[model samples]
Target: MRVWAHDRWPFPLPPRHTYPQSKYGLLRERLIAEGVCGPGDFIEAEPVRWSELIKVHDVALMGRIRRGQLSVREQRGLGLPWSPQLVERARRSASGTVQAAYAAFQVGVAMNLGGGTHHAGRDFARGYCLFNDVALATSRLREARLAQRVLVVDCDVHQGDGTAQLLRPDPHAFTLSVHGARNYPFKRIPSDLDVDLPRATSDTEYCAALESALATALTRDGYDIAFYLAGADPWEGDRLGTLGLTKAGLRRRDALVLDALRGAGLPVCVVLAGGYAPNIADTVDINAATAIEVAVRRTSIDRGGPDAKLALEPRDAA
Candidate 1:
């Protein structure tokens, strides 16, 4: 599977900042080291053009971001200090999802090593997110006539408030978010479908809720592609997450979502949404596991396996 990464372009962060900026690079290295993906499978993402961003974001907001003119309140809401490199990084990160969405059409699955910036709304940035990557990808795909119907499966511990706000009103898009009920973005925007698991929810309960949610979300069969925000923060070890899912359980969560999407015959674009494990390595481990799952599925499809045949069969694209 092809993976998009932008960690080579580093952005500055405050000393001892809570955000795990290192995990992106670590994940890329580990995936190559473990042979889950070859170095050639990794592609360096370019910064998304401002014209493409304006299709989904407000013009004023884009101007402020580009000119480094964000007010103190806006900066506070963004959670990251304004810098040229920061703006460049956000553009590159958003570009990765757009690139991955296009790549998924060729391969059964593709991945963006860093993304899932679902908290940035049309005119606002919040919760460490500066741009709604999935929304941008959706818009780009529609403009190109590659996909009219899109599904966003956001499993981050935090609600995808920005994504819900931007895409929920579109008749052709389905936004389904399974997140901690009491987590960040206390004033949540509703997705098309939301399954809010309680704090300290166990893996079994989490999977059960997710499986049911997937069943409901996949009932309609015309989605051209699905974007999966396979967040690692739900792990018990994560500082920012309140769930009780173990590493094994998170793997199960990935399988449940991937299998359902594959069964629905929708190509998958996987992204590393959020992971704040106290140990950075743990976050890397979880993200790597998600990549491994995508790789395994791609291999299955490439070898003319049952999954390949299932994927090739025509689906109702109404």
Candidate 2:
């Protein structure tokens, strides 16, 4: 499996900001240390083509961002100071997901170490997200005719409001977000399916909800591809996350999603989304478990191993 990472290139962030920009680089290091990937497996993502970006984003907003001309209000909405480097980072980060989509088609699975920017809408940025990478990638794959239908499973603590709105016009795209009921983006937009959990929701409750959501999606015609937004923020230690999922619970969650998708013979592109544990290491470990889960499942598929038996099972949601 190929892992796309753009954290090697440093981007400027506002001083005193609590956004763990360092987690990107740390995730890469931990992946290597844990043998989830070797140095060669990590590919640097190039900046996305403007043509591909404009498929889901607005041209005027893109121009303003590149020119660093966004008003103070707009910049605050992005949660970052506007700089050329920041712009480059956003472009490259989005590109990583686009690349991962193509890679997933070639391989059984692929991953983006710094993507899952689901909060950026077609015309606006929010919650530290400058661009909606997964949305743009879904559009690109559809335009290329690489996939007939796409599924987005966003498990971030905050709702994928921007992605839900951006892809709302496309019937071929389905978005599902299971997030905190009361978190960032208080005004949540609807997804194709949303399983909102109350604060302090445990792993069993979270996994049970996920199983039901996947089953409902499977009731329709199957999708050609699935984008799994493996967010790490649902951990109990996360300062920003209100739920109470443990690290073991997070790993099981990843396995449930990845195994089910792969068992259904759908190529899955994994994206590391939101994660904000009080101790950054905890967040990194959770992200590591996600990547390793994908890698292991992909390897099993490659060896013609037994398919996981959890793909379409029906279960009651907690």
Candidate 3:
């Protein structure tokens, strides 16, 4: 398996500032220590150009950010205390996803230790997401003609409102969001396919829903590539996630997506979506486990080992 990672410390971070909406660094740190990924596997991508960002974000709104002219209304809507560190952190997080996508396209699977900020909208940003990396990557792939059809599998507990909204008019990319029906972003923008589950949903029901969704996305839609937002927020211990999924349940969710992608002959690029645990360490651990699962599954397939391995194989017709 040619497992790889993207360098995500793209923005300069600050020392003291902290908030629930701004603490995503732990996801990157844990991936390194747990052998889920290493410095050797990581590739530093050039920061996404303004042209690439402008493809989805409004020029006027982006200009204000570039000028560091943050407003009270914008900051509050973004769910952060306005500071250079916070601003830089959010910006780099989005860029990391685009970098990960480029990496994964060349290999088979790659991950961005930080990204999956799916809630930022064009002409606006929100919900700890200054920019929507998932949307940005999808847009780039489409504009560059790298993919004809793209599938975005967002399993974050909260809806990917921004992603759904941004691509609602664009038909080339299909957005599938499986989230807690009662969670934040109470209002939703329609997605190509949305499976909204009730709060406190258990393992069996969640898995069944996820598997059915994955099968439909890969088989029915005929997407050539996919972006999987394996959010840690779905874990039962998460403070923000409304649904209660045990660690095992979360693993099953990841496996279902991975296997489905392989069965459909599509490559998947993973992004660490959302995780807000009362204990930050718990959130980091959750993301690390998913990363390990993807890596191991990738390895087993390359070696053609015994257990079910989620690796892409070209379709016979192709």
The candidate that achieves the highest lDDT relative to the unseen native structure: 1
Per-residue error at 79 for model 1, in Å?
A: 0.8
lDDT of 1 by residue, 163-219 (tens): 999999989999999998878889998999998989899989999999999999888
Per-candidate clashes, comma-separated: 0, 0, 0
> Candidate 1, TM-score vs. the true structure?
0.93
User: Estimated TM-score per prediction?
Assistant: 0.93, 0.92, 0.84
What's model 1's lDDT at 170? 89
TM-score of 3: 0.84
Please give the lDDT score for candidate 1. Answer: 0.86
lDDT of each: 0.86, 0.81, 0.71
Q: Check candidate 2 and list the clashing pairs.
A: none
Candidate 3 residue lDDT tens string, 1-318: 233333444343345423344344555556667755553545433345566678789988777766677577886677655555555555555666765565556556667767788888897777777778888877766766777678899999999998888876677788899999989788788888999999899989999999888777766657767899988888887878889899888888888887777567777788887888887787777777777767865523432333112222210110
Q: Pick the candidate with the highest TM-score.
A: 1
